[model samples]
Each structure stands twice: as C-alpha cells, then as structure tokens.
Target: MLRTLLLGLVTLAASLVAPAAAAEPVAEPGAATTQNPISSSFSDTYADPAVLRGKDGWWYMYATSDPLHEAPSEFGLMHIARTRDFADWEYLGTVFDEADRPAWTTGSSFYWAPDIRYVDGRYVMYYTVTDTVAEPGPWNFAIGVVTAPTPAGPWTDSGGPVVAPRPTGNGDYFNTIDPALLAAPDGKRYLYFGGFHGGLWVTELDESGLRAVGSPTQVAIGDRYEGSFVVERDGWYYLTASSANCCAGPVTGYSVYAGRSKSPLGPFVDHEGVSLLDSRVGGTQVLAQNGNRWIGVGHHAIVSDVSGQDFIVYHAIDRNDAWLDAPGGVNERPTLIDRLDWIDGWPVARAGAGPSDTPQPAPTTSSSLGIVSDDPAAGEALRAVAGSWDAGTDDDGDAGAVGRLVPADGADDAAVRTEASAPREPRVEADVRVPTGGRVAVEVADSGPSGVSVTVDDAARTLTVEATLGPRTVSDTAPLPSRFDAGEWTSLAVEVRTGRATARLAESRLGDADAVVGVDLPNGLARPRPIQLTVSGGEAQVDNLTVVAAHQPVTERVAEPVPGDEVFAEEFDGDLDTGWSWLRPSSSVTVGEGVLRWPLESVDVVGAANTGPLLLRTPPEGDWMAETKLDLDLGSGTVRNYQQAGMIVRVDDDNLLRLGDVAIWGTRQVEFGKELDENGALRWGAHLGGPVAETMWLRIMHTIDPATGEHRYRSASSRDGVSWRWGATWTLPAHTEPSIGLYAGGGATPATVAAFDWFRLYEVR
Candidate 1:
C-alpha cells in the first residue's frame, strides 16, 4: 500500500538540522561510544534502511526512494550510504537517477525498500516497483531485481518483475513489496516478499537468484506486518517485520516484531508458540519506540561483525521534530544502530533496553581476540587424558555423533584437553547431555584447573562459573531457568574477556545466549591455553565444541522509570476526590471501599461517537507519568471486539490518548491508541504493547517535545507492577493540556466490571 504522505508544511532546511543536543551521556559497552540516529550526521530521512557489508570492507546502507534531506522534488531514486565504523556515515547518492529507472516502469513508478545481497558471484538488489507500467493500476506493487558489480551499484535491471502483482479479484490486491532474500542452509535461495496486504510470504528463487521458482507461503498475516526481513540462525529461520502505521508523522507507531520457525518457509511462531498467522496475532517485539527521543522505529537489517556480534540497523523519527515541514509532511526517519542481543533464543535490541538516547559503546570494529575453533564431535581437537571416552550418536540423532566421557576406574573426574593452543579472551561452547546426578565442566584458557571453569550440575540444575588466577578467585552460581533440561542436548558457552567472564546455557541443541550471567574477574586469566572438558558422577556427551577468542562487551541495560515528586493521586478511599470531574457520567461508576469500579458499557469515545464516561483530572504541566492498576476480565481466546478499560489522556471526546486492556477479535492486548483530527476527519489508530493480563498496571509517560512543541506519550504495562514493559509512543499536538482520567466502555457482554485500585501521577525526574 502506498503510504499516506502527511506533508509537513515547513520547508526543507529546518528539518535537516541536527536533533536537540543530548543530556549527560550514558556509557555503552565498547571503548569508543556513539548514540542512535547514526545517519543523522549525514542524512535526515533514511527510511527502510537495508545494510550490508561490501567486498570493499565498508558497510553500505540503502533506503527507500526519498530525499536525503529536502523536498520530494529532490528525490525520485533510491538513496545509499557507506560507513566504516557505524559511528560515522557518508552519503553515496542514489543507486539510480530518474533517467536510469527501469524501462518497464512509468515515469510515476517509485522504487522502495531495497534488499541487497551478494549472491552467487555478484551483488543482487531486490526492491519494490510501485505502479509498474505493465500492471497499469494504482498500487501495483511488485518485486524487481537489479544486478550490480558491487555495493555502490552501477546497476542493471533484470528486465521484469521477480514477483508480479496479484490482484485479489476484488478492488483490493495482495501487495508484493519489501523484498528480502535468505540463502537457506540447504543451498536454496528463498525470496520473502509482500506487505501489510496479503501478508509476508516466502518463495524459493531459481539458481540465478533473480526470479521466484516456487509458490509462496505466507509467513505473517495481513494488516499486521510489512517490510519482512528473514535471517537463519542456529537452525531457526527468524522472520522480522515492521508493524502498525508506518507514516503518521510524530504519531507514527511503526515498530518491528519477530517470529521464528525451523523451516525457511514456515508456519513461523513467536516464543509463546503462537503462530504469526493467528487471528489474535503472535509476534515478539523486536524494536519499538520506547520513551526516548526516537519513535517510529522499524524496517530493520541485521549485520554481524567479525567477532559474530550482531547489530540492528533501522530507521526512527525524532518525536520532537518528526516531519520535514508541517504536521503531515515527510517524516524525518534517520538511520539508527543498536546491539542485537539474543536472550533466551530471541533477539532484543540493546538487551531489552530499547533504543538508546544516550551514548553507547560503538561496534567492535576490530577483533581484539586471536582465537581458533575446534569441533570435538570429530575427535580431532581433544584427547582423553583421564577418562574412558567413546564417540557415539547423542540421544537426539539430529545432533550427530558426540564424544562421551565417563570416569574410569575409581576416579571422580574424567577429563579431556584440546590439542589446539590456549586462546586470548577465549569463549568455549559445546552441546552436551549430562546424566542425572552428573556434572560437566568446560574450562578455557586454563593453567591446570586454575583458569576459568564453568560447571553445569544436572541434579541441582545450576550453572556455576569460577575464575581463578594466582589464588584470587571470582565465582558465581545461578539456578538455571526452568526451560533448561540437562538430560537433553543443551548448548552451553563460557567466555572470559576484558577482566570479566560470562557463562550461558540454552535448553536446545542449537546454542542460544539464553541469559547473561557474568562476574567481574579482575584477576582472571585471558592468556592462551588449551581448553579442557571434564565430567564426573556418571557420563556426559559433548558435541560441536567450538573455542573462539571473543572479546564481547556487555550490551544489556536495565530500564527503570525516573519519577519525581508526587503530583496528583486518587486512592478511592471513600468517594470521588473533589478535584475530579466526570465526562458523560455513568451511574455504574462508583468509588468506595478503596476501589473505583466501572463496568464495560456499550458506549465508547471513538470516531464521531464519544459517549464513554471518563473520570477526568487536569495533570501538572511538563513531563509526568500517570499510572493506574486496573482489574478487568474480558475472558481469553474468544471474540471480544473493543471491550477495554484503563487510563486515558483526553482533550475532548474525539481527541485523546488511551491505554487499555482491550480485546480485538480473539486476542487480549494492551493497546495504546490515539484519536485525533486529521484533515477535518476523525482518525483513530493504536499500537499494541507489552502483553496484557486480566489484572495489570498501565502507565503513560508524557513528555513535551521541545523542538515541535508536541506532547509525546509512551505506554508501559506491568503484570506485577515491578518489571515494566515499555511500548510505543504516540504524539499529540501542542497547546493542549489533556485531562488525565480513566475510561471503561466498548462492550456490555456478560456485564464485566473494571476495578481500578488507584490512580497516581508523578513528575518525571
């Protein structure tokens, strides 16, 4: 679908200026630090960014056809940029000028969402051809391919659409945009395409990698996803796609979600086992707008550094100065980069801290560790030292044969040492299955048993790591998450780098960085030494043993709300506070016994029909957070369209921001919605955030955007009111002090009541 262009009334120059200077910077993981909007130094609007490392060793990024930092008149072609260090970027101009567009396209056809890859021998570029001359229809989006010698691209079109437009018989059609290619492990080139219309899909490509050779399979449902990017990792194909409104200026709720399946063409599912095609929708949040300066974060590309550390490059709009000119103008989406940490088999940006507004450690551009890899399954890297070892197939036949070591004779420890030399800043990883009451230890950079040793105990279900050097020892022991079963083949890794050591465990055969369990090893040994594996008690089978010197920096950050002094609060001890006012008052709303209760009525404050009852109170000026604990039961796994109850920030009946536990179709979601006047019409849109429960705490963090004089409200919810899940942000126009309140209405089915424990507002510190 062609994105609705909300043209900003402002001119080009003002939008190109740098963002507001950041406050005191927060440190990141590496030696040199950088911040997000990494492309802002070069271009202002680099949307739908696709990044790849070139043969020239520079990382090149391509964007949808849009001006770098100017009016539309300056654009009719794709944009490209290059970076040596992600911290510094240089504009490389368009991939093709208007005069060089494909001959099959009309003058009005636009190119978008470039997917670049080095296929076979040369570089291949797959992109969206909107309004192709052959289709002769509006929104005739199709996938097109172009060949180039290198990433810079002196290119040539493949002469036809790779995937043609498929009309759905009605006036509507399935969109064939946002092309992505994944080279599967089985040597098949799978092309993933489609958008919010017709959903995301995957098809096998011909050996030439230019045309689809098979029928497509849907990866995600329509109306929920677009801009699909798939990556295969550790036997799982993870499909990441952008969701929600992509271009709503400052109010844009564009975010990224992820699902994975073992098959390239899959019934992909989220971590919860919910299929992406489910009516309720199932996707793990990958990148969403936190309460930072950046919003509308989506359409991402993942790149791995030399050390195997991953980075996510995407685009985001500055909520403060969102548009290039006026409110509905071109959104200023600058490219952003953050560490992509895999926690418990899922990829989360910056270890779940979301996007960074402060300085962060730059990507490790150079390898500081000199390492080697060894596969113990081949029995080539290890020699039995004090054990009776045998090579045999593991319990899981899919994992192939492994080295099984058991204590021989009367010895309590069975040990094997690697033939390769020790490594600097070493990380030792393996897949192992330990018998009950048994324990397995992986030691790296060892000086006898005095280096760094990670032990996994089956009976206790614990992961213990001890780092010792010259009698100084740093040790930590943590119980494994319930998912870990030592009796099954599990992936484990232990690493020591830069005076710190971390140990990780995954329940499955494919190694997952499940958790970050690290300790400061001030006197730890990082010098080169042979790796050693030992088993005691019973027996343990190990396979795929890999030892590499990875000097990886910690990337996870803890998210905490910064609250100032209390501003306003309602405890509902007896009756409504004198400071409160009611809009469309309802008899069902009652305050007593320390709780305010209201039922889900048939009325609502959506579109032109604004009849829902709201208990409103004016909030303090400037930044603040409004929180409410709501207990609303709408049942689950059933159709409960629009029934909701939670907090609301209201301007009038048709203009407001709402955070509610609402039901849509068959799913229960915490929806953060915004209703506003767009071109004299009432437009309502919402972005789903954190999961929802019957009893949940809803919070809306409001901050003033100094640049645009806009109000930014970000949603967060908590099941236990302790660890909050921050979601997307919605922007409201300036000069309006919206009344903060509570609203419950949408459905009257079964007559359910919403009990709110308390309403509290705090100044943002």
Candidate 2:
C-alpha cells in the first residue's frame, strides 16, 4: 500500500563575527571564493538512485550499487547518503547485509533497484533479489520486502519473497522487476512493475498489503525498460523512465523519457502521438549528453527539500573512468545531486559552480570614525569605499581593515560641504549612524539627469537627480525604507551615474555610526529606450531621443516602391453621384473633408454599363490587410446602406470574403461571410464566421496571410474622436481578389444616401 511521509524540521544557525581592531587591512570587494563539489569523493558503482525524505527530515538516497557482490553475505551492502542543505552530505555506512537474513531460503542475496516507503510510522524497503547460488524454487528471481523503524536500519525481512515469478501460461511470465507504488488522490493504492522484454504490469494491492485484489492486468508493453518512477501533478500522472542501455560507462548512452495520462493505467501516448508501448514510439528526451559533467544523468529520483525545491539525485560515471573497477576494488561511480529548475513546464539542470559557503559583508553606516574623507578642506572626496573591499579576506591574516573619520563637534545641524572645484570628478566619505529600524533620506541639489546609486552590503538602490556646485552633493543614506537590517556593521557604497562629484556626511552621534565604506564616480551616459512611436489623427509621431543599444548592426532595410501593387484601385470618375446615384454627407466621410466621401443615406442605384463590375485585383496570389478611414454623418432622413462600408477578398463562384453593410431598420450591421448565390441573389452561407456592429468614424482592416491561408478582418470605431473600440476579428480561406468597390443596397427610406472618404491597404509578407 502507498503511504505519505512527512519529514521533521531541521534547525539552521546564523554565524556572526567581531569588529576589527585599528590599522587592520581588508581585502577588496569582488574577491573570488572557492567551492567544492558535493557529490564527488564517494564510493563508485552506485546508479539508479531512489531518493526519499524520511520523518527525520534528512534526505535518504538509495541506489543500486555494485551488483557483482550480491551473495547473501553482501546483500544490503548497497550505498546510502544523508544530507540536510543538499550541499554537504553525511555518508552513512551500508546497513543491509543479506547474509544476516534467516537461513530459511535457498537464494543468494543479490539485490538491485531498491525502493523505500514510510508506512504506519515504519520504513518499508522493496528490492529485487535473485538466487544464483542455489535452486530451491521454480523462480530464479523475486521481489523481497523488509521493514525497519529507521532509514539506517537493522531490517527484518518477511522471510520470503513478496512477488514470485509468474507461472507458465501467465501472460507476463518472462520477468518481473522495477516495482513502483503510486498513491492516488482518492486514497487508493496501486503497484506498477515491468521490464525490457516482458512489458509493464499493474495490480491493486489489498488493504492487508500481502495479496493482489484481482488478477494482474497488462498496462503497457514492448522494449520500454522499467525504471519507472511515477509522479502526479496538476491532475495528470507522469511516468518517467530511462531508455536504452545505461551501464556501458562513457560509451554507454542513455536518456530519460516521460509520458502523461489522465489515469494511472493504460493508453499512454508520447507527445508525438505514438503509443509508448510501441517499439518504434520514441518519448521526449528530457536530459541527454551535455558535455562531460552530465554524460549520463538518467535513472534517477526527485527529492523535495524543506523549502519545496526539488533536486535530482542520480549516479554519473566520470568520463575519464572506463569501468567500475578501481585501485581499491570499489566501483568509482559516484552519486551526484544537483538542483533542477523548472522552465516552461520542463526541468532543466542548473549548470554552474556550486554556491559558496563564505559569509557576506555587513552594510556600513555613515557616522563611524574609521570613515575616510578624500580632502578635509575641499570636501569633494566623500565617504565612499573603493570597489576593492573584500569580505572574506582579513588584514594581516587576523583582522579586517578599518578607516576613521571625525565629525565637527557642537553644531546641532552639522554638515560637511564640498566645493565643485575639486579633481575633475570628486567623491566623499563619512561614517553615519543607523539606528535599529531607522530610515535615512539624503537630499541633494537638483543638477540634472545625472544620478547616483547606493549599495548596502550586496543590495543596491538607485536615485536619479542632478548635482550642483558648492555644498550641493549626493549623500548615501542607510536604513533606507526598503532595506532589511543585518545585526553588524556592513559596507555602504555610492556610485555616480554621470560627471565627477564630491560629497560629505553629517550625523547626530559620531561614535555609534557605522563605517562609511566606498564611493566611485565613473564617466558614462545613461541607457536609452528606442523605437517609441505614437500615431494619432492620421499622423505618425517620432522621437529621436529614444535610442536602442544594439550589439550588432541592423543593416537589413526594406525599400518602398513608388507605385506599389494596386489590388483594387478606383478614381470614381463618372458622375452618377446619387445612392448608386449621388453621394450623401456624413461625419465619417465628408465630401467637404477633401477626401472621396461616401454618405450613409439610401438613394437611387446607379452604375455605368462599363463599370458595373467594379472590383480591385492584385497581381500576386497572396494574403493582405486592407484599411480605409470613413466618416458617416447622416443628419436627417433614414441612414442605411453606405452607413457601413466593407471589403471583399478571394471571391469565387461559391465563396468570397465579404465584410460590410447588411442593415435592418435603422441599425447598421457589419458582417463577413462566404457569399453563395441561391437563385441569382447573394446569400451568406454558414461557416466559421460572424458579423460586427457598425459605428461612425470607422477604420476597417482586412488581413490575409498565405502561410496560414486565413484572411482576417478588423475595424475600429470612434465617437468622441479620442478612444476607439477595435471591433472583433473575422477570418476566411484565402482566395483570389478580383473586384472591390462600395455597395449601398439598403436605405432607411427611398431617397437616403451614404458616402465614403479615403482608404489605404497594407500587405503582410
């Protein structure tokens, strides 16, 4: 039966150091620290690690170690390691020795693939054991069960195998191995086990834990090997396993694969739509050969830390090593543990040097005596420490470096002022006092866009402002509103954004102040943001100040042809101006607006014999987005037909892209459809399409992209001339564009008319 284990909490301690004496020197900041590998320097031959968290809160890593010494005397000799922070691990002596088991059985104690679960406050271990030394039963190999109260155990076996080899004529009689227990949300228990040649099987375990409830059912089959570790997250169960040969050393290549299913049993398909059971079906390779460090990092288990961070504990053979044999005769294969960070729903191994164990420097305040002032008279040199302060190294190999600064006595509001005329760029340093939980705010003269950034310990904060001459300096403040406090004296830093400047500090008490550490003024311009543009009232506004920092030169440019491809171009030269006759005026498309305007009132329908089929055609067979602005202002009479204008593309005998007016009563309806002729009259056929609501001041856009073979239409309407609601998007299959023109068929009354204005089309490649 499956069980849930809750590990107990582990305690963490914070270390503190004492203040340095006078004249002691300190190393510069940014000094490098050395780190050690957590997994190296251990016994080899360990692979296929099954890591679990016990109730003691320590991580227990169990693996299939050397298989050669599996005799009853060497059973349970496989390795185990315990760790708390995942950095330093305590090597636990091997606790299991098969020879210690009762002499009632006839098998050797060779074990492989060990798994541990905490049930009923006891630790239960399951492993595959085979009797190569003696033959006492029909089965050569079987799963053995043992129980212990603690992970480091003197285990008591059940005296016999829990699962024996299947009898002849049974479907899965070949081999039984790789057993995994899964606890479902419904509180039921299930067992899954299988191997390379025989396939995987699942069975429900009865509450008593000794028997299967029913006959075992075949879950999956084929060459998919069975180091299956099943995990469920977000309502889906994921079965992760290793594929291909894993123990051939460097020459042996293996990868991890996974498949997900809504249920725990049956019908598992890979991302590529192939059943996992099929020999040809390949699953996703989550981790593969990545340099020499992680040549083969599969057949592993995941262990979650107290903070819920998951780490992958697996065995990897060094590329330099050829085999498990070593000078000590102990396999050199070592178990490696690395933090796995999730990105886009997939786990990625963090590849870098391990974290350092050295403590960081403390943030310094503004009033301590050790603070150094660049110039006592000029005052340009501020209480800024050089960037070379080292926290790890001690001066004279015994104590840290110190600086001293004296504050002017008496004056309640004492201030240190610096003249602008110092070195081309000047800086200041002064020790300022920081009360516990207190905040410091420094006021500087408004110089311009130039600014300064302050750093407390390792954290940095920036303030932008200008600087002025004579007493106008930038001050570094401590206990800033957002900074968290550390108990001891820490380093404070100030860096100038632009131009050289000097500074000084004034505080209430000089003795209680923290050391003012470093100040640096580097010459450079601030970063800029480019590509900022705004379009309004049919005009494009550009800003030159916005500049993009480019690592590589952007040389590719597009040239605009003088006369581009005109899919549908019309001048409306004829004078039939009534609805089909002449145009009526509206606010959107005004004849007085100087652009070609189409009114929104119904009138007589007029068409010349030659221009009856007024349509626009493009030379290329491609998708395009056409846009046009129109103003519809029908003051009196019924406004219809031309009130809503639309465009059409890919017109065929049966289907065409039609978007525009199909009005009923006084409301204007905007729609796109596949035009079909029922009995000579145009009719919209039902498909994956819909209609849009008509509005005034409309800019309609129709887009076509050949890559997707879909034509889309969008529009925006405005009432107060400011804000606009871009209408819904409609799409259709790409077809050839032959004719495009204004169609005003329905009108509110007999003599109403609609007008049109200017239009433009943009094609996307």
Candidate 3:
C-alpha cells in the first residue's frame, strides 16, 4: 500500500508536466528522412539486419555478412553500414574480416545474421556460424559472440559459440538459429531462437550473458517462420517473425507476422486467438507485398527514438533489381526504414507498396540530455517513488520536488523510492543530503523472497551493504573513505551484482575505490534487479539521480542453415508419377505407359506469361539430361508468336526458359528463347530454322560449368529420334532452381494438344 501511494505522487507530478496536445507526426515533417532503398551503391546487397544508434549521433546497420563470391575469410565477419539520417548511407565494409578468420569461431562461410547490444560500455553481438551444411542430423548452427568498445568494430570475438544446436540435430530440435534476446520483467535475460522444423524457442541467460542458464521452451511453430525480433512495450512482448519462402526473387511469398504474449517465453497466440503452435497461419500480418514491385522483404529491427516514436529498419528486394535475373542484381535486397503506428496495444505498419518507394518519417532524433524540449515524451513518465514519503523543500535551497520520509511516530524506517521496471543489471548514483542522524539507502528487492539494501549511514560514519536474497540477511560494511561532511550534500552510489551490492560514499567523486565491501543477499537474486530508494532516521533528500542498465541489447534478433533440398526422379507408368506434379492449375494431363498427354485449355506452361505446356519434377543431384519425343497438334488455326510446345525449364510463374517449336511473327520455326517475366516477353536466343514435321524428338541438357560456375542449358531438335539439330545455348539466372517439363502456349487457338511418346531423364556424365 505504501509503495503504491508513493508511486502515485510521481505519476501525478509527471502527468501535470506532460503535454496536453497531440503532437505532429514525423512522417512528412517538412524535414523528413530520405528516400527508398536509402542507398545508391550498385553493390548494396544487405540482409539479416542488426541496427544500433550510438552516442556518436549516428545509426549503424549490420547484417548477415556476405563473402560476395570472394574466398572464405575474404570479407568481414558481418556487413556494416551507417547513416545520420535514414536516407543516404556509407557502407563501412565488414567487421572481423581478418586474415584467417578467428580461431575461436569454426565456420565455412561469413558470420550469418547477427544482433548487437551495448552492455557495460561495449557492444556485444550474437551471430551464427557453422562448418558445413551437409547432413540434417548433425547440428547445423553455432551462434557466437564478439565484443567491441564501439558499435563499429575492432570487435573481439569471444572465440566461442554461446548457443549451439543440439548435437542430435534436427529432431527434438529442428533448428537452433535465429536468436532474439530480451531482458524480461523477471529480472532475467532470455534468448529466443529456432524455427519451422523444431518450433521457435526461448531460454534464460546467465549474468555474464555469454551462455544459456536453462533449458529452452518452445514458443511457436508456424508453417514456416524464421528471422524474428521481439520487443517489449507496456508489459506485452511482441514477436515479429518472417513467414514463408523469403528468398525467391520477384515471386517470393515472404511476409511479416506478429504475435504477443504476457511472458517472454510464451503460450503466445495471434490476434485471432490461434496458438503459435499451429501451421502456416499468421499470428497477425504486420506487412506484405501489397503489390508494386517490392518483392521479398523480411528480417527486421525495431528501434524506438529518443522522442519515443518507433521505426522499423529492414531489407526489401526491389523489382528493378529483381528484373536483373543474373549476377547480384536478382537478390539485391537493400535496407528500408519507416515509422510504425501503435493502435490500441499492438503495432501496425501501413506500407502501401511497402518496401515502399516513398519517403518515410525520420526517427525523431533523441536529445543528448534526454530532455525532449519539443513536447511530452511518450514513455518518459516520471515515476513516483513508493512508501510513506512527503514532498518538501530541502535545506539546500532546492525547491521543485524533494521526497521526505514520514516515519510512524519516532520509530523511523520510513522510505520513498521507485523501481526499475524489470530485473536488470543496474547501477544508480545520486546526490543526497542527510540530516544529522539520518541514512539514505538504495534497495534492490525481489519484492517477495529476496532483496538487498545499500545504505550510507551518516550517524555511524559508515557504508553498509545489507542483502537478504539467499537463505539469510548478511551485512558487509566499510568505514567512510573520507568525511562526508554532514549538513552539506554528498555523492553516493550502489552497484548491483549477482546476489550482492556494493556501496560507495565519499566527499567528492571517488576517482578510485579506497575500499570495497559487499554481501550476498540470496541465491535467487542472481539477476541484477530493480532498486528502490529509501530514507530512514532523520530527514533525507535525494536529487540529481541517475540509473544505468548493462543489458539493453538482448532484445534484438536472427539465423540460416544450408536449406534442405528434395532430390529424386519420376518415371511415368500406368499410375500417376510421384515426383512429377502440376504447378497450380493449367492444361490437363493423362499419364499412361510411355506417354504423358497434355490437353491445353486456356493455359500455358508459364501460367501468366511464357507459352508452354506445364509439367515438373524435383531436380536431383549431378547434371540433368532430359530427352523426349513430342507430336504437337496446333489444330487448324493460324499459329502466332507464342504458339509452340517443347521443353519448359521453370523457376516460377514469373521466370522460366522455354525452348522448342515457336511461331514467331507469322513464321513457323523451332525458336530458342527465355520468357524473362510473366508478361510473355521473351529474350529470343535464336530461330532454329523452320519446323520439319509434327512429330519430332527434342532434348534439353542442363549442366553447371566447373570453371565459371554458371548454369548452361542447351536445346536440340531431332528427326526420326536419331539425327539431331541443336538449337542455340542459353544461360539461366544463377540463383534460382528450375524444374523441367514439356510445355505448350500460344495465341493461335484456345485448344491445342502436346502428345509425348516418352519423357526420359538422366544424370549427365
């Protein structure tokens, strides 16, 4: 009751001083942030974002480090960039990109997605690294850490992984990547990680915060969720994770999903009351490709500015780059920033054509002194210190609002204090004036089973660290280093450690410790906790107080493994082939012995663009050689440009390579071309002369060049299934997968037929 009433006073005072009007938003603030992509580098391929605003007035961006085709250990450990305004940026190259990599970190590639926190004046980062992605059962990821004096390295890797996958690998734990750290209300640091196969999970970190202290709890298992960051606001923990395949160029299905929970390790459900354990469903859609060319955009970081407005920074693929289809352009995901809206208790990001091309509000820059001279700060509420305390003027000429203890009669022990919202590694200092017989103390209590109180007793001329956390209360005291002249103000501070407290009091700023004393409170007080200020004995006044926490960055996210692949073959028999399946809906297919007949309706191999009859199979290892005999039945109609059927190498509806018989501009010929987009616009390779007959043998060969490493595809036409005439050779995008099948599409007739005598696939020598 005392704590409640004492806190009420601070709340009331803060409320009175706060702004009364709704302030203008930063969005179109005549002086808003900058443009889309926020970057102009032709080589800016950023992903797996990690962001931090330093004291230096600049925001630094870090993400999954890419080696950019360089040899291992070539680029830095992680990609780094910086900007004063969110618009233009300067890429700072990589961090930890040393000569031989670090001996402590064992990985075959660049450090994957990483997140960083500023703890104890240094930046600590968590990242994933691994040796090889060969087997499923073997643990695939090892999350490591590195510390630096600044956000921009010279980072010294701890030389060890803090979170590693279970040695048993992909079973009870399908993944041990994408870690999100949080400092919860329980006064503990927690780490959240995992995805799809095993479900997302959470675990507690020890005080050092370099390793896990407990078993992990599974939180959610969506259809496919990864790359998540968790943020805490108003007692609720919000998790924003990416769902679906996020890397496929223009046709990617990646979107952001959100869910909230009362506890960090949650039985979290979405806005619909559905459990996170469910499959493929969104907790709540945070953002998606609502159209206009922004492709796959996921992996985000949420940053709250000093003015208290929240902004999200992430990576989104630009359609302009998506159209490149070769080299680094196809997947050149650039960083994006935009303001976030909080409606009710949740966050909503309204991005029209998100990964939006329009300019967004810049993060309201935080003042160096933390005072928002403009208007009331959203969360900078002045808290009332609880207990039986009265407001009064101090003997020292100070008059605004000073707390005075009101004891019961002459019994003393009365106090006034506020608490840190959660259990955090804390350090607090304050200037205080103690009456002749008084004591001013700061107490860190669990409020239930344990607590510690560090007091500066002027009457006793000593400093005491009294803690009651473990099984009993113990006192550790030290004589005053020098006279803290009574009647005048003195500076005192207390530092909270794992189950212990250290108090320092002196006449002036204690340059170095003359004496150090401490006592263990309780074993359970392992987490540095919220501390309270209390005054006992004579009147005591506390002012110019400051508090600091060491674990602020644990709330950031991230992970990736060598994606698993499905490889095998399919041979059509009397029954439907197992490996071969129709993609969505298109022409009808009837399978029989040595034959698969495609009856076209108003359909094409490329659903919206390329003209071809659709059929598909999983690409197995080694080179692929597909040969087939086709009898094209174009019906009695004038065949047009796309009127042809042959071999289809499809990546998706938007991209594919169709080569074979094609009617180009009123001419009938076996044309080799690539339908680069769903628009049916083909990058014509060449016209392989005119067609011989309706029945011809066709073969498409796909192989990876050992030298240049580019995928090579060749098409050949044959008569009598023996003598062959080869067509032009073509190259497909280096970063996509293709499934081979016989296809037919054209503007000639609504109805067409493609009959195959036999479709054979082989592993090329």
lDDT of 2 by residue, 1-765 (tens): 000111221000000011122211132476221122344434434566766654333556666635322122232355677664444567675646555743434433445677676533356666655442233443355566677767767677777655666544653244566666664433344566665555667777555343356766665553444566666543456666655444434333344556667777756654544456543333433443332333434566655332223455555545456243322223234556544434334443331111112332111211112222211221223222211111121121111222222222331122222222122221222222222332222222213444333322212322222232334344433322222222222212222224432221111111011222223333342222111111111211000010111111112111211213445433344432332322232334334433454433433222111111223344234434454444433332133334334454434434444445444222233333334333354433211111122233443355444466555444334433344333333344445444333443334444434444433454433
| Per-model CA lDDT versus the true structure | 0.74, 0.39, 0.55
Q: Assess every candidate by TM-score.
A: 0.67, 0.40, 0.49
578 Cα displacement, candidate 1 (Å): 4.9
> Candidate 1 at residue 88, lDDT?
80
Question: What's the ranking of the predictions by TM-score, best on top?
Answer: 1, 3, 2
Q: What would you estimate as the lDDT of candidate 3?
A: 0.55
Runs off by more than 4 Å, candidate 3? 1-30, 41-43, 67-76, 132-139, 167-173, 323-330, 351-353, 366-765
Residue-wise C-alpha lDDT for candidate 1, range 438-539, written one tens digit per residue: 799888777764678888887786888888877688888877654455566565767777777777664321122333366777553678888788898878
Worst 10 residues of 2 by lDDT: 9-18
What lDDT tens digits, residue by residue, belong to model 3 across residues 637-730? 2434456777778777656667666544333445454545535433222323223356877766677656555555656665567655443344
Query: 387 in model 1: Cα distance from truth in Å?
Result: 39
- For all candidates, what are the clash counts? 12, 80, 15
Kindly give the stretch of ten consecutive residues in candidate 1 with the minimal lDDT sum. 10-19
